[model samples]
Target: MHGPHVVVVMGVAGTGKTTVGPLVAEALGVPYAEGDAFHPPRNIAKMTAGHPLDDEDRWPWLDAIGRWAHERAGYGGVVSCSALKRAYRDRLRAAAPGVVFLHLTGDRELIGERMSQRKGHFMPETLLDSQFATLQPLAEDERGVAVDVSGSPHEIAERAVAALRAA
Candidate 1:
């Protein structure tokens, strides 16, 4: 059998990473790991309180997620991460090479609206601006695809699966 096909469903907050990650994983017959689940308590508390995490706060979290990806390699898995910066993605790649990224994108207003309507998530609507400010779209050489998140979750997941296959 081929190695695990690890895909990171990524984007700014409220782009539907949690909703779409599992769908993509299910479609691909892989396990799904929620990115938020990997965040430490402090990180969650900080975000819950409307504070954006700095690089110092992120490296260890990213490393933990990367470790999960590494362990799941050759077995197939999907994970959701903000992966808002190229450097962050690079860290993940360093830990698990050949990890594909599915970058969900949408308009700020739409995303903000979605954030406002969501419930029980640690990330707040107030941090939406910081997320976008820190976001760096996938570079030309990155192993990923960008899928617009304007459609329903099902549609978005289907599009992401199609893009993943093509990639």
Candidate 2:
């Protein structure tokens, strides 16, 4: 919040990263990018077929998002990414230093319910467990904040903005 920085809105599937990311970007007066758009066709096909992506399948997608974040460095931007592992976040940070994270978190039942209600998303609800299993919460050394996903997208985005400001 002190200066322009790229913020990665991160979380497991159905935690509303996509829904809340744009609102956070709007509140911060920055451009927003959908992390899913960086995914290659094969990745989408695998996920649509109900398969969880391995590290190999994710590196390229993460790199693509990282490139965009690097381009937005110091200019401010927000992007939604299911950065489910510490290694993935580290990789992104390596590509775009000073990148901050906004982690969206919620209980499994709530997230599963949200996934069930969603339509046309390639990530199936069946993959939710794998997503949770892979998630690595932000560490103390990380420049980030975790916001609970327990309300409307706007409310969650407001919380994200406040948390980022405080961070």
Candidate 3:
């Protein structure tokens, strides 16, 4: 039996983590946290100014998201994060061992197109290249599944829930 399911919906900027995370949480009857919300003003400012965050800039933000996962471990919850690198995911796992990642993935062109269509978001489409460059896919040993984002948001969420169960 599983202890609790802490799902982190992760991907590069345009993969729809924020869009699908809440639906997954709703389906699972768990609390939802937007990983972007964990970012400090400085980080947000940096990103808004078109600066990609270095590891130093990311540590505290990841720690905060990890803390949230740790706090909600027993009951389970879902959070959206880029978790783009293996090290970043490892940092998160240090906080909640059972945390599972749902990685949304797609081609750069498609993602860039989606990002371009987005409105009022702090992250600019200009950063999509940086995001893709930074993304280190979940390894074979990692406890995660990658779902393609070619479908609608609802469909993507359904696929995520299914993948989580299958995992």
Give the top-scoring candidate (TM-score): 2
Scored against the true structure, residue 23 in model 2 reaches a CA lDDT of 97
**Per-residue CA lDDT of candidate 1, range 1-167, in tens?**
13457899899999999999999999999999999988889999999888999999999999999999999888889999999999999999999997989999999999999999998988899999999999999999998999999989999999988888877
What local lDDT score does residue 109 receive in model 1, on the 0 to 100 scale?
98
Per-model TM values vs. the true structure: 0.97, 0.99, 0.97
Candidate 2 TM-score, C-alpha based: 0.99
Better of 1 and 2 by TM-score: 2
Candidate 1 segments exceeding 4 Å error = 1-3
Collision count for each candidate, in order: 2, 0, 0
**Whose lDDT is higher: candidate 2's or candidate 3's?**
2
Q: 35 in model 2: Cα distance from truth in Å? A: 0.3
lDDT, candidate 2, equals: 0.96
Worst 10 residues of 2 by lDDT: 1-10
Error of 1 at 109 (Å): 0.8
Q: Which stretches of candidate 2 lie over 4 Å from their true place?
A: none
Q: Give the per-residue lDDT digits (tens) of candidate 3, residues 38-132.
A: 99999999999999999999999999999999999889999999999999999999998889999999999999999999999999999999998
**Alpha carbon lDDT of each predicted model:** 0.93, 0.96, 0.92
Q: After superposing candidate 3 on the true structure, give the runs of residues whose Cα lies further than 4 Å from its correct spot.
A: 1-3
